[model samples]
Structure formats: structure tokens, C-alpha cells
Target: MKILYINAMGPYEAWPQAGVFVSERVAALRKNGVDVTACSYYQINSPAVQRVVTRNGGPDLGTPIAQQAGVTYGIRKIPNGFFSAAMQRFRPNFWEKRIARQVRRDMEESKADLIHLHWIWPMGLGVMRYCRETGVPYVLTCHGGDIYSDMKDMRKRPYILKMLEGAAAVEFVSKALLESAKELGYSGKNAAVVYNGIRTSVFYPARQEHPGKTVVGFAGVMILRKGIDYLPEIFRRIQELIPGEIHFYMIGSGVLREEIEKKMAGLPVDFLGTIPSEKLAERFNEMDILLLPSRQEGYGCVIKEAQACGAVPIGRDVDGIREAVDGFGSLIAYTGDDDAFISAFAEETAAYVSGEKPIDRAAMEAQAARCSWEERQKDSIAIYQRILGKAD
Candidate 1:
């Protein structure tokens, strides 16, 4: 069966590291003789776009390069200027119609059996429109921002809900997100939870002898949602509990980076700036702990990656993160309360520091190893087969 995998956030060639997760899934399916062709919206990485894009983080939308994976895909550039970019802040109503047309054209030309859409957005709405027109089925995967952040807009809520309800099947990265969708008014019967996996080849236990203080790492767009604002309080509490016991290294850049850096000045923190995904594992290897005080998540991919690299995971006891840890890492502070978050961090790490319950790096690696792209691919293909009624 011809399978079309659509990524709304990428032209994968430019997204490199982030793109690898999708490419790995495609490659795994390909190995099983399942025909999967991936496609993405080509981002125009110009100076004007850079101003907006970097506001959230660094150039995650890097320059589009030639596909080095030896597999070609449908890569269409977003044909819009500053105005279109500004307007698409809440919904891509303008250029999305053209993209929707492209999705239909791609499906028709490829004779695709099904379409796998990454984000249930404005783009997913377009795909839904196409599916209704052609009677071709499409699966929608709801990543974090699409549901949590996008759903807040009353104008876009109807479309997101429709996409959730109209999907041939809805695959949520975390069970909490699935429930969130249902709470937000989706009575869909055909929904499932498919946890994300890392490329094990690139991420694995690689800890060396680092004899200094315990190095804690934080990676992702530094913003309110990621709990960047909690840094000062969290750090103060951790230090009060275990003085001079931890040092921090932060990755990714965002609107809060400068303010956070300034606030964290004179502290044992190093703002490493935004590192590429390919080299992320190297940095993970240097850390003894990975701290992600995120208020929200869609299956903390970074948490798993850190676990795979032998870093003890520490984060909020929230939705996707809860599943990502899978009883392997340390999770505390259920509420967004600063004191509770701080106490949880201290309580969770004190044992390790005191040698009462020291970190077992090997076991952490094993947890991550248990579920990977290979396993996720099998589950995904099974779902696809079920959807298409293809026993083969």
C-alpha cells in the first residue's frame, strides 16, 4: 500500500535532527516492505521569518538541504511573505488552502492508500477537506502545540475538534493528550495512544568519567510552557537542599532565554545556547541529570533521549512526561506551585546524592531500549493495516 507521511512543521532536510524521528519511522516501515513516502511543507528560512521563528527558539527551520537519506519526498515551499507569516500566527487560513490543494494533488499523484498527517491544525483541516472530497482516509497525529496551545483559540477550536473527530484514526503521543482532546469535546471512537520513540542508533548510554558536581541538562524551547520561569526558584530550592551539589547546562533559545540567563547569572549555570539535535546526545553524555520542569508536554522526547544517554530524568509529573518516564525517572510536583516543584526536585535528587538510591544508568538505558522507532513502526503499521483492512 502506498503510504504518505505528512509533516506540517518541516521540510525535513532542513529540520535535520527533528526530521530524523519521522525519517526513522519511514525507514523502519520501508524495511518491513511497507511503502511509506514522507512529505513536508518547505519553510522559507529568510531573515523576516527568522525574526519570528527565533523568537520561540533558534533556527529549528534551518536551510533546506538535499535529501541525504536516499529517499525522495514531496517537499513544497510555503509560498507566502511576511504578511502570510504574521497572519498564520493563529491559523494558516491563507496559504493553507494552497497546501491543502497540494496534499490532495500529492495523494492523487502518488495513488496513496492513506495519508499520515503530523499536526491537526489548519493544515489537518485542509487534509480533512481533501479526504471528504476524495473519500481517501487520513490519520492525524496531535503533537503538543497543536492541541494544547492551538486549541485555546476559539476561532481554530472548531477545526481542531473536527480534525480530531473526522480522522480515520487519531493517534495521540500521550494518553493525557488523548483525554485532553476528549475533554475539549471529541467523542471519537477511533482513537489510540502511540508513544514516541527515539533513534536508538543516535541516542544511547555514553556516560564517561565526569568527576565534578552532578551536571543537570535542560533542552527545549525555553519558554513559560517549558517552565523556564521556575528556574530561579527551582535552583534556589535545590541548592538549599543539596548545596553545591548540582550544576546546570541549558539548551535551546527562546524569548525567555535572555531574562533567564540574567536572572541565573552568578549561579552554576551555563546557557549552552541552541545545539543541533545530531550533537545533542554528546551533550547528554556529560550530564548526570536532565531537568525539564515543563508545565506541559507531548511525550517528552528529550526525557527519553536523556534516559537513553544515562542521565537521570527529572521533570513535572504531568501528562506526556509521566508516560515518557514510565516509572524509570524521577517525577515530582504535580501542581504548578513553585514551592512544590522545588520540594519535589530536592526530594527526588537527595537520595541519589546521599547514595541511598543511587542512579542505575544501565537500567535507565534498558527502559529506553525497550521501546524505539523499530517498535513504534510495528505498532504504526499495524494500525495502518487495520485502518485499510489489509491483512497483508
Candidate 2:
């Protein structure tokens, strides 16, 4: 099968967390004997664009375009400058406008059997328009943020409804995401759940010795959406109650680092500062728990990554997080109930810390293995085959 797989970000090295699923899936499909052409938006913010376009610094396009692993990777540059900026205002969906020409170009050039789009917002909407006009078939996959953003703000709800309506098939990372879209009036018949897969090769059961400390770690950008405010308060409360049984380690940096530092002052916290993906599994292995009280998620692949290393996860029971933590870890209600959250965290890790409840490393590893990319691709190829048969 020949597939044109498109998404908002790419080339894994530049946007690791955002591009990983696509990158990995492309490799998996290629391994299974599918001809896949991967395309992504090589964008820089206006400031970076100004720096490059004005000849002040290097170019704004991220990561040099490459073709590797039997998959031809393509880059679509979003044009810059005054006329382009003015041109953008005329379009209701700015991203759709930026991506339309590129999407059309890709479609005409590829002669692909199917087009698999990663998100509903920009790429899917553009593809929807193309399919409606050109009679080409494409599939849409909702990866959390794309659908979640429109759920609260009804301005772009029609675009989402139309995009979902036109797709030959629709995919979701979790069942929760599909239901949420239905709440937004997505009555699509072809939609199904395909959980995001973890790299078990990097993350597996190899418990590192932390020696008398119940290390609970948080690994993600420190931002408002990650439920960052709740971290400091939870840390203080847990420390006051548990009193020296736990040590907090925060990973990844963002705009709120200094603010979080100020709040976490004098606490037993270690700011390791953005560990690389290859080295993150080592950190997970040392942890007894992975605490990310995120406000929303499509599916927390990090939860599965940590679980593969035998670190139980304790997070908010909302969106995709609930499914990721269903049988593996603990989930507190999404009501932002601090007391309830802290209690769940304490209960989930306390027994492990005291050695009363043994960590079922095999069980956790088994759960993580079940969600591997290799396993998920089987279903993806099945979808591709079905869509192709219908197209024939």
C-alpha cells in the first residue's frame, strides 16, 4: 500500500514529543512493506521568520529536509513577510490558508493510494476541502489538542464537524477523545481508538536503586496546561504528611520555571532540566511514580513509557489520561480536588515505598508492551487496506 501521511510537525529531532508518533509510525509502516511519503509543516514563529526573512540570522525553516528509511519526508514552508501577513487576515482558519496550497501540491504529486492526516484542525481541514473538490479519499486522526481546543470554543466547531464528516475514516488516540468529539456532534461511523505507542526498547523494567527515597518525578514542559500550579502545592502537602519518605524531581523547562522554582523554594526538589529522550528512560527507571496532573491529553505516552520502566503513574482522570492510567496506575477525579489527588498519590506510592506492596514489574511491562507502535500499526494497515479497497 502507498500512503501519504501528513501532520502538523515532524523530523523527530526538532519536535521530539510532537513528532515522535508520526516518525515511529512511518518506520513501522515501511517495515511492514508499505510505501509511505511523510510530509510536515516546517514553521518558525513570526519572530524567527523576521530574523531569517530580514537577513538578521539563520533561516526560519526547522531541520533540513530529508528522505530516509524508505519514506520520502517533505517540508512545506509557510511563506513570510507583509503581503503574506495581510493575506492571512482574509481567511477564517489561518492554518488552513497556510496549508491549502501545500496540501494540494502534495496530493497532485504523490498519486497516493490514501492520505492519513494526523490532526483535525489545519491538515485535516485542508484535506477535507481538497477531497470535497477533487474527489480524493483521506482519513483523519484526532490527536487530543486539535479537537479539545474547539470543544470549549464553538467558533471553529463547524469546521471540525465538517472535517470529521468528510473523512473516509476517523481515528482517535483514546476512546475518551472519540466520545468528547461526539459531544461536539461528531456522528462519524468509521471512527475507532488507536492508542499512542511507547518505545519499549528505550523504556522497560530495569528499576534503578534510589536508596531510601520514594522518587516521584514529573516529566513535561512546565506550563499552565500541564497543571503546574498543582505540583508545588501537592509537593508541600505530601512532604508535610509523609515527611522524608519522598523526594521530588522535576524535568523539562518552560516559561514558568522561575515561578515554579520560587514556589518550590526550600523543598526537597531536584531540577534536572530537560533530559534527552534517550536518557529519559534511566530517569523513569529510578522513579517509583510519574506524576503529571495535566489538564488534558490525547493519550499520555509518557505514562506508558514510565509504566514500561515499572513506575506507576498518578494523574487526573480526564480525557486520554484516564485510559492510559486505567488498570496500570491511579487516577483522581478531574475536579482539581487537591486533597483527593494528594491522597491518591500517597496511597499509590506509600506501600511501594515501605516495601509492603511489591511493584509488579512484569504486569506493568506487559501493559506497556500491549500498546507498542508495532502492535498499533497492524490496526493502522488494516484501516489503510479497508480505505484502499473502498477507493478501488
Query: If candidate 2 were superposed on the true structure by all CA atoms, what would the RMSD be?
Result: 4.1
Runs in model 1 lying further than 4 Å from the true structure: 11-20, 42-73, 81-96, 236-246, 276-278, 334-336, 390-392
How would you encode candidate 2's per-residue C-alpha lDDT over 1-392 as one tens digit per residue? 77888856544443344456777788887777888878876544466446655485332333534543234567776655555555545653666755667778887798787788886655665677777877777887788777788544676777778888888888898898888888888895879787778776777878888675678889886777788778887777667655466788898765677889999999889997766666788889888878878888778888988888888888877867878876777776754566777666666556556666676778878878777777788888898888888778
Please report the TM-score between candidate 1 and the true structure.
0.86
Model 1, range 245-300, lDDT digits (tens) per residue? 56778887666788898888777888877665557888888887788888889889
Query: How does candidate 2 score on lDDT?
Result: 0.74
Candidate 2 segments whose C-alpha is farther than 4 A from its true place: 10-15, 48-72, 80-90, 94-98, 243-246, 334-340, 343-348, 355-359
lDDT of each: 0.75, 0.74
Clashing pairs in 1: none
Worst 10 residues of 2 by lDDT: 57-66
Backbone-clash count (model 2)? 0
Candidate 1 residue 80 Cα shift, in angstroms, is 4.0
